[model samples]
Target: MRVDLFDFELPPERIALRPVRPRDSARMLVVEGGAAPFADRRVSDLPSLLRAGDVLVFNDTRVIPAQLEGRRGEASIGATLHKRIDLRRWQAFVRNAKRLKPGDRIDFPQGVTAIAEERHADGSFTLAFGGEEPVEVLLERAGTMPLPPYIAGKRPTDAQDREDYQTMFAREDGAVAAPTAALHFTPELLAALAEAGIASETLTLHVGAGTFLPVKAEDTEAHAMHSEWGRIDAATADRLNAARAAGGRVIAVGTTSLRLLESAAGEDKVIRPFEGDTAIFITPGYRFRAIDGLMTNFHLPKSTLFMLVSALMGLERMQAAYAHAIANEYRFYSYGDSSLLIP
Candidate 1:
């Protein structure tokens, strides 16, 4: 389909710079399948919205302080580490990259530094950190949270974002970006979901900086998704399959979870154990073998995420839903309001 079909006007003020206090206070827009009227709700109402025995799959990948400002002599460079090739090395999108080349050393804060080992076709560099202190440790000392450009461009990332950007489920550390939808969940909400008999499970998908990239492709077919590492163990897969077999719905908490689940599901619709990288590009024509619903933040115009939601619900349905969201003043983007899309 033409990418232009997904385009819409969004007022700049609609973007959320920070989350509401007591995370669960954020508003949620419930969009049902077909011609159902869109419902205005709050994140705290999620448990009541979902049925008993439904499984909510969350991404447990933790966000690292991937944004680093450094210098090679007089040239200032900024790097956002998006993928980890190994313990000591990462693939990063570097600003001031025009001044860098393979084998240049960049000096960062806290005495941390890295060597630009290889430059990829996409202009990202493979950076190898110096010394033996774990890369996470170095990042803690030298880096700041990798805020989405939409937000970062508006203001600086302050200390508050360190906690606000992370979800309650964050555990495995690797993701450059946070699974923003999950950030709305709170301990109180978890207890409510449990009381409502709504089960939850976790998997890992290290969200990359690629999520922030604009879709320059004119058509959906031409767009290529960036690969991000994810994992689902045998036990989790078995549990998910069993839940589905028992008539429970599998609700992915974010596109990250939905994409990973779809990647692991066989044509038979059974999820299997999976590990490694995935560049799953979900478009309107794509068939969803897993996930009965999706809970995610509002996305950018003409973005792959909007395309994914359009695929989950029909294109016309999503277009209308988004129109309702905008008209109702729902926040947009990573730090925005939430939406529970059931199809």
Candidate 2:
């Protein structure tokens, strides 16, 4: 389908600069797979929205401070680590590429430095951090949280974003981007959800910097989807399968979790142990096998995320729902409000 089909008008004011106080207080637009008018709710109200037997799947991948500002021979450069190749080397999208070359050593803040070992065909570089210690330590000292460009371009990432960007379930660091939908979850909310008998589980999908890249293709078929590493352990898979066997709805808390679940699931809809990369590009006409519903944030116009949601619901329905969201003053983007999409 033409990428233009997913386009929608969104005013600049709707873009969230920061998260609402008391994370669970953010607004949630409840869109069911029905003709019912969209319901306005709060993130805290998630427990009341589903049955006790339903399961909420969350992404546990932690966000790393992957955004770096550095210099190579007096030329200012910026890099966002995209994927990890090994213990010390990372695939990164670099700014000021014209000034960098193979073997160039870039100096970052906190005495951290890396050598641009190779440039890939897609314009990213293989950066090998110069250190004997773990790269996470170096990042903690020198890097800032990798906020999406939609937010970062409007304002500088600050100390608040360090806390705001991470989900409560965040652990196992690797992701450059936070699974934003989970940002709405809080300890109190989790307690409430558990008390209400809404079960939850976690999987890991190291959301890469590539998630923020725009779809440059005119058609969905031409778009080159970026890959991210994900995992589902045997125990977790067994639990999820058992939940479904008991007639429970499997709800993915974010697209990251949804994608990984779909990638691990077989034609019979059984989820299995998985540990590898997934570049699943979900679009309309795609049949979902693993998830019964999704909880996600409002996405950018013409974005792959929007396309995925459209696939879960319908193109026309999502278009109408977004129009409703914008008109009702719902926040948008990474630090924005939440939406519970049931389709």
Candidate 3:
């Protein structure tokens, strides 16, 4: 399919710069399968919207401050770590690629520094940190939250983004980006879900900076998705299968979770233990295996995420739904409003 088919006009003001206060107060647009009318609701209404025995799978991968600004011999350089290659080495996208070469040391704040090692064909570099201290500690001292360019381009990142970008379920540390759909969940909403008997589980998918990359491909078939690490243990997979066997629906809290779940499921639709990288590029005509529904934030035009949703529903359905969202003033992108897609 042509990538242009997914394109839509979005007013700049509709892009969200920050999350709403209390988290759950953010509006949610419920889009059902087929020709059902779109329903406007709040994130807090999830407990009532969902039935008992339905499970909401959340991504527990924590966002690391992967954005770094440094200098090499007076030449300014910017880097966003994309994936972990080793305990001390990472593959990163560089801003000043022309100025960097193999073996050049970039000096960051707090004496934290890294050496540019091998450069990839895509112009990314292998960054190896220089220190005995854990790389996490080095990042904490010198790195800042990796906000999506849509929001960061409008305003500077601050201390507020540190907490706002993270979800309550964040634990495992590896992701460069937060599973923004989960950002709308709060303790109060969890309590309500528990009281309502709507079960929730967690999986891990270390979201990379590739999520923010634009689809420059003219056709959807030409687009290649960057891999991201994810995991689903035996116990969790067994539980999810058991829930489904009992006629319960498995709802993914974010596309990261849905992608990971689909990666773990078999052709028979049984989820199994999985641990590795997944570069699943979900587009229209793809068959969903593990998840029954999805709760995610609004996505960018012509993005892989929009393609995924279009697959779950249909191309025409998603196009119309997005039109309604934009017309209704629903916030867009990470740190934006939520949507519950039931297809």
lDDT of 1 by residue, 1-343 (tens): 8999999999999999999888998999999987889999999999999999999999999999999999999999999999999989999999999999999999999999999999999899999999999999999999999999999999999999999999999999999999999999999999999999999999999999999989998988888889999999999999999999999999999999999999999899999999999999998878899889999999999999999999999999998988999998999988899999999
Task: Give all candidates' CA lDDT scores.
Answer: 0.95, 0.95, 0.95
lDDT of 2: 0.95
Among residues 3 or more apart in sequence or in different chains, the pairs in candidate 3 whose N, CA or C atoms overlap within 3 Å are none
lDDT of 3 by residue, 147-186 (tens): 9999999999999999999999999999999999999998
Candidate 1 pairs with clashing backbones: none
What C-alpha RMSD separates each model from the true structure?
A: 0.7, 0.7, 0.6
Question: Which ranges in model 2 have alpha carbons more than 4 Å from their true place?
Answer: none
Q: State TM-scores per candidate.
A: 0.99, 0.99, 0.99
Instruction: Give me candidate 2's TM-score against the actual structure.
Output: 0.99
lDDT of 2 by residue, 190-242 (tens): 98999988999999999998888899999999999889999999999999999
Look at candidate 2 and tell me the lDDT of residue 162: 91
